[model samples]
Target: MSVLPLVFTSGWASGINAYAVVLLLGVFGATGLSDDVPEVLQRPDVLIAAAVLFLCEAVADKIPYVDSVWDSVHTVIRPIAGAVVAALLAGQSGSLPELAAGAVGGTTALMSHFVKAGTRMAVNTSPEPFSNIAVSTAEDLGVAAIIIFALFHPVAAAVIAGTLLALGLAAVVFLAQRIRRFWRRRAQRRAERRPTGPGVRHPVPTDGSEHF
Candidate 1:
């Protein structure tokens, strides 16, 4: 079976939540649930590490500003993970070069990562935490579900993943201006709230132009 679909799906998932994708692939591969998953990923140590990181991400992803920080930190991690997973999948077939697969994975992951990070940054502008929790949960569930589905129906899963990636990218582009404006407004609010120095005082107009 061509590993192209799995490669795309894994790349997309990794961008959103690399640890969750790793954990799912490891668990499924270890249990004989997925033939496409690579053996290295199914190692007990790998699974354990992925599970721990997934847990940490789950917690950090539900907090507003913290999630953005987490995303920023993972900017490098996620793309690397995507490339590794793609290379592993390609290795299973021995038909595609690891380099080619890694390039595909890295490019896809970078695109999706940008969309994810931008969306989260925009979301963080909101004061409420519920949206963050909801979005985080949705991403986790989406990664888990897509990886599982790809095990049985790689083409279908890949199509869905592609569609999602396109939509997400479109959304990020459409909202770019709004996101920028949101940050500008936030900065303005912060400036307004900042306390002035104790000695600072407004000068009185002696010309008697009415002080509003």
Candidate 2:
């Protein structure tokens, strides 16, 4: 079976939740359900570490501004994790070149990361915490479902991931454009409200003699 699909799927998931992808892949490898997963990822220590981090993320991701801060910190971590996982999967399966896999994985992860981060920032605008919790829960469940399904049907999973990624990027662009327009209008209003510049003369009342 070709590993490219799994690579792309995992890369997309990793952008949202790296630890969950690692933990799920580790379990799949340890259970002997998938032979494409790297041996190192299946080790007991690695699994344990992934589990702990996953739990941490699961909690932090539910908070409003905290989630945004967490996203900021993981900006670098997610793409790296995606690249490493893709390289390992390719190297183990020998179905794709390691460098090529890494490049694809890293680029995909970075794009998806922007989607997740931008969405979170937008969601953070809501004063209620429920929205944040709901969004975070959905993301976690999404990652789990995609990774699990990828193991059984990689091609379909990749197609789904790619479509979702495209939609997400579109949403981000729309939001950004809206925000830019808002700020531009606000600046224009401020400029209009300003007092007239120096040297501009006001109408003078004439009483016998008006000063020129």
The candidate scoring highest on TM-score is 1
* Candidate 1 off by > 4 Å: 185-212
Q: What are the per-residue Cα lDDT tens digits for candidate 2 across 65-108?
A: 68877988999999999999999999999989999999888888
User: Could you tell me the lDDT of residue 173 within candidate 1?
Assistant: 91
- Model 2, position 51: C-alpha lDDT score: 99
TM-score of each: 0.87, 0.83
TM-score of 2: 0.83
Which residue pairs come into collision in candidate 2? none
lDDT of 1 by residue, 1-212 (tens): 68888898999999999999889999988998777778999999999999999999999999987887798899999999999999999998786788899888877888899899889878877889999999999999998999899989989999999999999999999889867976787689788987788887756788989658
Global lDDT of model 1: 0.89
Off by over 4 Å in 2: 177-212
